[model samples]
Target: MLKMELFGESLKQIGCFQFSGVPCSYLAPMINYAINTNSFIMSNNEGDAVAIASGISLANYKKSFGVVLMQNSGLSNALSPLTSLNYTFEIPILGFVSLRGERDDMGNNTDEPQHELLGIITDKLLRTCDIAYDFLDSDFNEAEQQLQVAYDYLAKGKSYFFIVKNNTFEKCALNHDKNIFFEKKINTLQVKDSNSNFLPKRIEVLQHLSYFSKMNEIALFATTGKTGRELYEVEDLDNQLYMVGSMGCVSSLALGVTLQTSKKVIAIDGDSALLMRLGALSTNAYYASLHNKGNFCHILLDNESHDSTGGQFNLSPNVNFAEVAYFCGYEKVFIISSFEELEQALCFFKNRNTGGAILIYVKILKGSKEKLGRPKVTPKQVASRMANFLSKD
Candidate 1:
């Protein structure tokens, strides 16, 4: 088997230093190597890992690469962002998916029964997602060549994956010791039930947030759906990335951007989108504290309905988002329903300097202005410009 250093060093030579993913036994060696030598964000799930990698790739301006590692079963968890976020945005990431039930020379399946079906369909699934992949070579020199080929594809803004079999890399010990502890504080501002309907509309909140972004010179990631479309209508700036299809990934992607840049990064999220991946809140909070990213702001526009999909009622009303954020490890949490509270919250965020991410849960009504329009700027252009914006000193 090739030493893990050979693979890791080769990836470094090819400009890939950022890595994230869920744990897999076959991938443990490479994961250990990355943990010891590079920046690896152990994501809460595979999809978030892909989206975080996308954020790193986008912010790096193609000068560096992000790698994703997961088991074949977890590939299903990664499929959404891999297709919707990476493919749609042309964000390239090097993915290594472990082959759990690979066939041997005699063509017999050689893995656990649990992996049978997924193993049978893994390659087909990759093809269906339009991801080109190669079997990781057992030879060190050949694998180094494979890394260069992967870089070639990544340079073209196309993701290249590697299907890794068992024992592909020599065992490597995790030498890094990491410790992160943050107090969970729940701070809430009570709003009267009578004032619920009178709360700010989604567009008004966007207008305020858009203004705050412009005034602070921050990068904003608007979640998929009306939040992004509305932000596009509010103001389409080079520093704003309007997520088109990767629902529930805005915060995790913002976390990636926060790790890559010192600029304040704000993510505008929706109730439905946040619910799609509730685990992201915990992931974002954890990394924010671990990395000491005080500039990350997670704003959830809770309307209790999916306004973009005909205003269907959702479960947001039953849940206390501020408490969730608090328990999830956000250093600061604010619940605001009116413009006055929002303004105060923004001022506090701007003035504050040291803490983890700040979560602003804004309760709003579920309605948009008549004839709301989508962004005229293409997703690739958005990604490119945001990369350039982040690259600036």
Candidate 2:
């Protein structure tokens, strides 16, 4: 209850009545409170939340602010916008991340292996981005003051963050509009060309992406999944952007980078990750309508399983992703089930209008790479490199 009161007071004090970001069990109490108060904007991913906040700040113009909440691991997904777009373009964002493995944090035994590094590096990652942040462990007044400091930074064209340990906040009144929380629909589209039934192996898709990489006009970003690992192994590690953590957000990050630079951006993502955060497609459509960045291409590789997590099955119903893209507002949507068709789609996307985004769906087989290597560089390094790359003429 003390934590809830402190969080409420902090939100009111900093003028951050609006909140966004994907849900995490670690921050359930805070998320529940935000929803209860009708101040939460529940976005598709951390990156989408940051982009939305950026848009809100740009449109409102009177020091508008929003809160992005996520697990520490999701920080990798949100770093692109945090560094390249927000830092470079001077868009202020405030993040409230839930720390998963504090000395007294709950659910430590049940946590995933991937979250271990995130638990240790959260603070270091923030500092690397040049963001001034504070850890809210138990002191209510200290948390409030930190929020104020964060607000000040946001007002001055910089991002601020406050990391709270898990379960620090107690349950409060559920005062949010229930209508705002809606279940996302699964979108699966059948390929129009059934004759081209030859799907490419992961190696083949990687080779084709390599061709795109050679062009110098395109930059590739991979999400956290088999697709990302395969791309990492097959592509030049130094030349491409690989998200070691932060599932379901490569597309949004690429969109932010594309918005900032003229170079075409490609995101290699997976079906499970896409299912985890489908709301990003709608956000992409919305942003495309406003900014019209023609250089963003989202390549969704559908394997129908969480291959990185013990090949768990995703029971998403067959829905049309291309139609979903169209509904979300992308002018160019191509769904291909075969390698040849994918190649054709890629060629078509390359020549399409530079005003809207393009989505190309590539269906692939699901399996783990036995000896896939992890990323050597930290998330901050990847972010800084992306910022530097996008800033160059």
Candidate 3:
């Protein structure tokens, strides 16, 4: 039997302890072990895991390799960030992928019809993503050899993968009954008095954020599309991180940043963007409650349309964001549809978030200024700047 603790210890010895992933039956015991005894995060999905890993790795730059573990069936989910975010930015991650239906000695020939095709093409997919891979063995010595290969690739600013057979990790059962606790708190949400013209456009909100960030020691993470472009226009301060491509991941990235920094981390998001990664709302809320130091804030701009994507309809007209944040466990929820409300909410969270995590819903107009430009810098540049800023404090 492979000792899960030994492998985890080896990973720590080499300074690669940040682990994030979804659970798979093949690696349940290992995941359980991680939950019990490591700085592990239950990333909402495979791709979220990749992004969170990237954030953690970037936070611990020069001293960490973010490890992502998932099943072969979910590799497709991870392909986006693995290629665009991690590979493009030269972020390294050691992946442990379960071979759900391999044809070799560890093959599950009769496992499931769905796992068969995914297993057959797992290595092909990895190769297509320009990721190098090696199969994992039960022996710790063999695993260390594979880790050495991954470490070598990481040293050169690249990613690597490990394909593992089922049952490679010994059983580590979850005692969820004793380890779990849930408490639902009922609190009324507050709204500020503000003007509701929706005239200034989302750009105005970005401008407000720019001014606010300049005055306060804050870290700002913008969502993809116009929100990012508009923030770029406002001014790309070292503290401002514009998420260019990942639509719904801004909050997740901000959450990861909050875990590493004491700065007031805020995710400036859009309506469509928030809808795309609704799970992030819950994830951030959960973590904020656990780490309830008021280190995180979520500012969502609801224009009622996907203005960045040709103004497509995003969500129902009646969706109450304040209620969503309230139920999601935000320490304070503000439903601000006007400039006054927006300003007041900003002031409330400015000096200190005495209440807890905050969500500010800013309803704005649909159109932006003519000839709005994109980020002049590359993603790696933006990521590196943000990473460097976060590392300092």
Candidate 4:
């Protein structure tokens, strides 16, 4: 049994007495402690936990901290809010992640195949999200210090996490307010009024890219949501990086691979997700400048809406993506509105070596893939395969 008194005291010291997220058997001790002594809220899912935390932070105008307790498998489900809301709005959260079956000293492996991936790739997921976190141990004093550091990061508008292994904390009382109140406020206003026919087609751009490049030579990283689904439906997505979750991060992931691998890494990112983490472009540019790797190409499909979520307007202004790329230190930036222009841009990007990132902005129509199926591989599996692939000659 794990004791939460130390962790609770640390939370109290940081003034982050509020908690959120779903329950996990591994987190029962901490959950029970929180319910017994702190203000905690239980959400429907991990994503909802993040959303509610975001709301609380925005409403209170204080550094709000929420402990999202969920099984490692629920990480994918929580990524949308993690990458989008947290990354975009710079909402800080302290995730109390329960690592259920990660002990090496265990006699028999009770973990499922799904959990294996989660356990292996949890750090990678946090890294891609640009979140810094630490693993929790039984040492109450050390855990308290770590929690304090997490609180400080949260104060600075960055998400931090504390990964807890199974049975790490001692059992405690459950005395939380049953009614964890959250206001239900919805924004129903449409930001854009024009039903413009000027937007281009996603299929046209995909077709052009497929035609221009040899499929084997070009590795595509598709962002989560409609852009990924569309690419999966259009191309032979055998080993292509089809992001299951973690929206607004395909470009960053592409940059990571482009830095290490010799293959051309192309990221098919959506406008909404791109806008969510626009700072990623600057980060990518900084790294590209440092490493001088110029094989990264980010194809931004600007549909001006969150097409995956019922076509809600993302308020993405009609800004020149080329200009944005140039400002971010991209060596070559191309804003294409037609198939021919995209083809020419691709050719130029393939040959350019100015030691920077490239942004190819394609104006696309907003549409959802009604029949797009989920990818077979998990994020952990993909990470493993990619690591192995990079390690090879």
TM-score per model over all chains:
0.94, 0.58, 0.91, 0.51
In model 4, what are the clashing residue pairs, if there are any?
1-169, 1-170, 2-169, 2-170, 3-169, 3-170, 35-175, 35-176, 36-174, 36-175
TM-score, ranked from best to worst: 1, 3, 2, 4
Q: lDDT of each prediction vs. the true structure?
A: 0.85, 0.67, 0.78, 0.64
| Candidate 1: residue 177 lDDT (0-100) | 65
Give one digit per residue, the lDDT tens place, for model 3 in 1-393. 578888888888766787888899988877887778746778777887777777777777657777888999889888877877777777777788898876767655646878889878999999999998988889889888878878888767678888888778888877575553357443558653345455557888889888888788688888888888889998879888777666677787777667766778888988887777677766677767666567888998877898887888878366777778788777778777667767887887776743457898777788877898988888878878877887777
Tens digit of per-residue lDDT, candidate 2, span 1-393? 346756776676666766677788867877787777755656766777776565445333333565678888788878866776567546577787877655335535335676777777899999998988888656676666777777788777678888877656775656544554233332334445547565666657877886766575567777765666677667554447766555665676665555545667787877877776788988666555445556677887766677788878885437566677767766667777666767777777677555566788766667756787765565545554544555553
Model 4 lDDT tens row, 1-393: 336776677777876666666788888876777666535555545665665455345323333444566666777777887886566556566787777546366644457655766777777788888889888867877777787788778777777887778778876756554543322211121122245344667766666665454443566667787666666567643345556556665675565456545566687888888776676676566555555556777888888888888888876766556567676666566656456666777877677554566777677777755676655555444433444444441
Top model by lDDT, which number? 1
By how many angstroms RMSD does model 1 differ from the true structure? 2.1
- Model 1 segments beyond 4 Å from truth? 176-198
Those runs of model 2 whose alpha carbons end farther than 4 Å from true positions after fitting are 1-47, 51-93, 96-159, 162-196, 237-239
* Residue 201, model 3: Cα distance from true site in angstroms: 0.8
Worst 10 residues of 2 by lDDT: 180-189
Q: Please say which candidate is ahead in lDDT: 1 or 2.
A: 1
